[model samples]
Target: MGFKAALSKVFAWYVNRHLNTVRQNAVALQQKTFSNLIHDAKNTAFGTDHHFDKINSYEDFKKHVPVRDYEELRPYIERVVNGEADVMWPGKPAYLAKTSGTTSGVKYIPISKESMPEHIKAARNALLSYIHETGKADFVDGKMIFLQGSPVLAEKHGVQTGRLSGIVAHHVPGYLQKNRLPSYQTNCIDDWEEKVDAIVKETATQDLRLISGIPPWCQMYFDRLSVVSGGKKIKDIFPNFKLYVHGGVNYEPYRARMEESIGFKIDSIETYPASEGFIAFQDSQKEKGLLLMVDAGIFYEFIPSDEYFNDNPTRINLKDVELGKNYALIMNTNAGLWGYSLGDTVKFVSKNPYKIVVSGRIKHYISAFGEHVIGEEVEQALMGVAAEEGVEVIEFTVAPQVAPTTGELPYHEWFVEFGKEPKDPAAFALKVDKALQQKNIYYFDLIEGNILQPLIVRSLKKDTFINYMRSQGKLGGQNKVPRLSNDRKIADELKEFIV
Candidate 1:
């Protein structure tokens, strides 16, 4: 076998070895991982304050470190930014990933030296897991394009600050750099449009095998490639393209359009990597969820989604999570984040493998008029409608349109940007409305009781979502249009570009 093939085989063996250990006894492996975490950082300031040395069990640790979001951990992160050693982790953070989450805007998440290993290892293992499960490793010898953020980083106090993708780009191993497209200089372009133009010029002729990015941004790149290549599908330019790795947004809505741009159906791997850490990735083709990284230097916890807004919420560990229940994720990682609320929700799909599917964001759901709908539900509904109507939905977002006058019931307003507009726009809207009613009982009840007016669909001009994202200065990386919002914050802004 060739050297690349041998390397692929060895990488697969290594990741699968750990995969088998976790599958054998996930709880035991998690317990051991947690033990190492507390013991390793016990001397750190945050660890000492929490008496990590005295913490001998999960119960002991949970009682001492209360659950907190980025806002709650901001003080410690600020201290780390100000050159404080052993603040959260044992030493100063190597970089701070600056993210503007839908709810928690502008968070500086620390990535410590100790945590960097887990981050890099989890990412490598994600690709390795796909190779192991599918027995496809030829991609190793071909070019791979990671549509990531600007690689140019800035300093915040003594710590480097940039988008997570840019920070990760800096650490791309030397060997893989040979196969990676869009040179570091092109990636350093701060303006997204300019970056995409440069990327297309640099990589349009490469023999690309792997492509990875958020669904919307990837769609943008694919569309541009089609336009630049004289209406040629992506597969025509890069026939070796085999795998599309996606995360940060649900791929369902963009699936048809993406496949159309590529000219063929290709294999896909989904991952759930947040700025805080690399969380999970799809491990099996037969299964539909991502395997939790049981030993990735992170101890996990879950709060039932229903109870998440409660004054006092119950936090359950990995062993206690039930199948098919939405739970907001809380994690204690080696990076010194203890019981940190990741602000995302997920549902356990397999106990034996500890696999889960990301459900939605904590604050990205719509609960207006007692109709609670999440990203998964909205995405499913949109996909169902689009499939039935023979339409291709590029992107969409939903918001409540509260009645301006008395005796008028509130209703849902949908902003749809269509790749292939349905033959009948009115009928398309009706189908979408019916799909939601079928998926959500509360929504059905509200419509039946006249508590909500019929759902309204407003078709948007081409490039509406893109323009909106540009206006917000979040045109690339992990930023995405929130699928559902309680209010019209996003909807109001998107109105300017509406058709």
Candidate 2:
């Protein structure tokens, strides 16, 4: 190892030791975090309205503050947006994270100054933990790229506002400023394609070592690199490329195709970051799940996924959570979002250290006929079969076909874009369907009882998903195609590009 890598190890060692201490004292740390957050925001408008100065204990807080999604909480958030002080946090938020919302258009999540540092620290600590575990820190010296949205910000109600990735771009630590890539001008280009071209022009021959982004965009970059370099694999272009850090989407569907683009495998770390706060990250290459952040400014609550829609769902803390049960993640952050629903569901894989695997979005599912198939189940089933059959899945989504055009029984319709289409498409469909049935008992019963026919795979042309997103004017910058939907909104649009 070089001097820089050696030095990183010493620093990583201390951070890892601290993380271990936090992990071991998870319950105590969370209680302290909760107390600190409540105490800090007690004077804010939200706190005052919710009776923050009232009685003690989680029960008292829960009684005072009912759980709220962005819509339910928007009354106070709107006050903040109108330049009101102490509406959510103690003062106005440092920045407002703009995101698309289903019920309410253009949701703005508050990020207080105190909360912002935790976002930076959790991400940095994830890397440090990796270096400590693997003793691989040489990539720190090489050029790194984070394929993201433009860093340009717009003033919104007296606060800077932009995509979270873009906001983070402006805050890249001084040490990494030199190593981070695609110049500010290139990053600021509003058009994704134009920006990508500029990035490829600048970094095609650089010592690019670490790449970070959502999986789909990174795949697009690799494909662009291949075309520009006369079909050369990404590995050939940046020989020192060592690590891939990704979040915002499950990597299983994109993993095989990504490796093919690279011409080999490379190490990857998965993170669970959201607009509210940085939640968790893969702390060890050997672990199957991301290590949930315990000491971060966010105090967490979990509602059983199956019970989420119930009028009064059960809410519990990390101390009471059980393994393998899916829970809708809730957050009460220093950002001043109180009892806020994150809309994502995650399941615990390990206790003490608290490792969690994101299961699926609470709203993203197929239950048209009572078979509540989730993202995790569908991905596992399709990828399981695809892996065994030597098929490489590019992208896919599932929706229930309640009424078949063929006048047959209703079935699930799968709109898929394939990197490698199976030789026997009929057989491939059967395998994927059977695999899914095995995973979901409800689905199995529906198929066995003739309530639904086997799923139909409608293989789509290349750029099918891209075309759909572009048609909606959501082609890039953290926009993702839903894996499955209760309605036919996405599947109907995808029909335009079907092969």
Candidate 3:
């Protein structure tokens, strides 16, 4: 082997050894992280207000700091934004991750220097682990692309501020900068289509071996490449393409369409990284879950998702989390977010190594008519029926059609854009509806009681979802249409794009 490949093998081996040791002491590592966070922030404004100096255990921590979403935590964050030192973390944060929020509009999440490296390290280590297991390090030598927001940042209160992806763009390690794609000028283009056009122009003929992005944007990239190459498969355009790293959304729903775009399946890694913390990453090709980052600079607590809206939900530590039960993910991080609710839900798939599968978002679900369907159930239902029908789905969303225009019964409306439409659309809808009924008993009872009719699948025109997102100025980056909603806001707007 060449020097670079040999060196990568050695590094991957050492990193894997280090990671095994770290996860083996998961509980102790978490305890250390918790204690360090409290000790570090004891003199900060929020710390003092929450009596952090007196917090000696989880019990004290919980009693002192109640769980809070972004809006509830805004007062303290406002102080931080106004040039106040020691408001959230010590002195000041390195950057403010700007993200869209439901209640707070544009929210600024602090990222201290201490916590920034965890995000970089976890992403690196995920690749190292993959290389160690598969012995595939050649991809490191080829061009790589990560579909992300513009790297150009704006100033907020003397601190740099931008989307989390944009902020991370400023920190791409020096070694890989040579192999990274879509020149800095191209990445800074504000418009998504313009940026993709530049990316396609620059890299269409280059050797691209590794591609990373949320699946939909990657699909957009692939489609652009295909059009440029006269309808060639992605694998034909870049024959060496091997690894696909994705996160921010589940990949299964887009799998069939993406695979068709590529003309074959490829190795993939799923990561659970948020502005709050780098939570987990897929560590093994054989494992079904992403391994939790125990040594990362974050303390984790989980509240049962079912009980999340209750006045007092049961919150438990990593050691106490049970397998297969959904829980709302909470964190106290080095970034000075204490008792912060991520609004995302997850279920522990493995307790020994503390691995988890993202179940759904706490605020994004369908409970209309008492069925309480979740993201996972909807995804799995669609995935199962698609497999059985041999149809390829491009995108879909579920919303309750409560008020039928002509006085028909209420039903779940599925807006689907199919790359390969089912030969029997009604039968396809029936299969998916049945699967959802089996997954959620309440939905089955609602159907049996005649309170709701079978789900109605509205086959939409190609790129209907894309057009809708573009119209809303959310065409790319990490923006995604909600999979399920309790109301008709999205459902009503989708009427303009029906096939």
Candidate 4:
């Protein structure tokens, strides 16, 4: 066998052996993880305050530590930012990952030295699992273009801080760094437009085999590569291109356009990593959901979505979760975040292997008129229409049209950027409305009762999202168009670029 194939065989064997053990002992592993976490942090102020010394089991841990969102933990994080040691963890965190906030301002999530190893290990395990499942690792011997955020970090209170992708860029393995495209100089450029240009120029002639990024920005890069190489698809430019490592956002909406840009199909591995921690990754090709990272330095809890907004919600650990329930994720991690709400909702698809599909952000849904529509429902409805119409949705955002000043009744306004223009716009909108009505009983009831008007689909002009992102100065790297909003803030702004 060739060198690449031989290497892949060996790597695959190792990954499978380890993963088998994990799958077989998922429950036991989670229990052990919780025990270890409690032991590790027993001396920290947070642990001591919660009586970690007396906590002996999952029930004890939950009873002592109530669920807390970012706002609740902000004060402790602020103290950490001000250079306090052992305030949260054993010592001050080495780095902070700055995540953009919707309700609150910026969130500086701690990345303790102890947590960094787990972060790196989880990411590697994700790739290794993919290789083990697919047996396609020839790309390892070729170049990879990780279209990440700028690696230039700024200091806050003597602690390094930047975007999560930027933080990860600093720790790219030495061997992979050699194979990674877009020179460090290019990656360090702060301007998105200039950095993309530099990346396109530097890697146009290289032996690229793998590309990794959030799909929207990667679509932009692929489009640029096509333009720079005389309208050639990515496959033509790099015949060895094989895999796509995507995370941070749902890949469904961007899939069609991204494949068109590449002019061929490629295997994709989805990952679930937030500023809080690396939570899960796709470990099986047979499944759609990501396998929960039971062994990672994070203990997980779940509060049902229905109960989450209640005055006092019920919290359940891994052993208590049932398949198919929508739950808001709570995590206590090695980085010293205890009972922290990650703000994302997920539904378990498998119990044996503990896999979940991210449903939506807790705050990013349209609930006007009491018809709650989440990200997963919106994505499915839109993609359904696209499938039936044989068109592709490039990007989209939805907002409630509550209390219109004009005589028109209230409804949901959809601003869609299309990769392939539909043959009939009116029909497309009708089909989308029908699909949504099918998925959400409350939305259907509202429509039937005439309490809510039909959904409106506005065709946004090409590059409308790009222009919008540029206006907000978040055109690249982990930033995305928020799928749903409560007010007309996004709708009014996006209307300026309607086709």
Q: lDDT per prediction? A: 0.86, 0.90, 0.91, 0.88
- CA-only RMSD, every prediction: 1.8, 1.1, 1.0, 1.4
Q: 262, model 3: CA deviation in Å?
A: 1.1
Output the worst ten-in-a-row residue range by lDDT, candidate 2: 1-10
Q: Which stretches of candidate 3 lie over 4 Å from their true place?
A: none
Considering lDDT, where higher is better, how would the candidates rank from best to worst? 3, 2, 4, 1
Q: Evaluate residue 73 in candidate 2 and report its C-alpha lDDT on the 0 to 100 scale.
A: 91
TM-score of 1: 0.96
Off by over 4 Å in 4: 1-5
Winning candidate number (lDDT): 3
Output the worst ten-in-a-row residue range by lDDT, candidate 4: 1-10
C-alpha lDDT of residue 265 in model 3: 84
In model 1, which residue pairs have backbone atoms overlapping below 3 Å? Answer: none
- lDDT (Cα, tens digit) per residue for candidate 2, span 214-305: 99989989999999999999999999999999999999899999998998889999998888999999999987899988888989999998
Whose TM-score is higher: candidate 3's or candidate 4's?
3
Q: What is the lDDT of residue 343 in candidate 4?
A: 88
TM-score of every candidate: 0.96, 0.98, 0.98, 0.97
Q: For candidate 2, give the lDDT of residue 363.
A: 89
Error of 3 at 190 (Å): 0.5
Over the stretch 160-199, how does candidate 4's per-residue lDDT look in tens digits?
Answer: 9998888988888776787888888999988888889899
lDDT of 3 by residue, 363-432 (tens): 8899888788999999999999999889898999999999899898999999998888999999999999
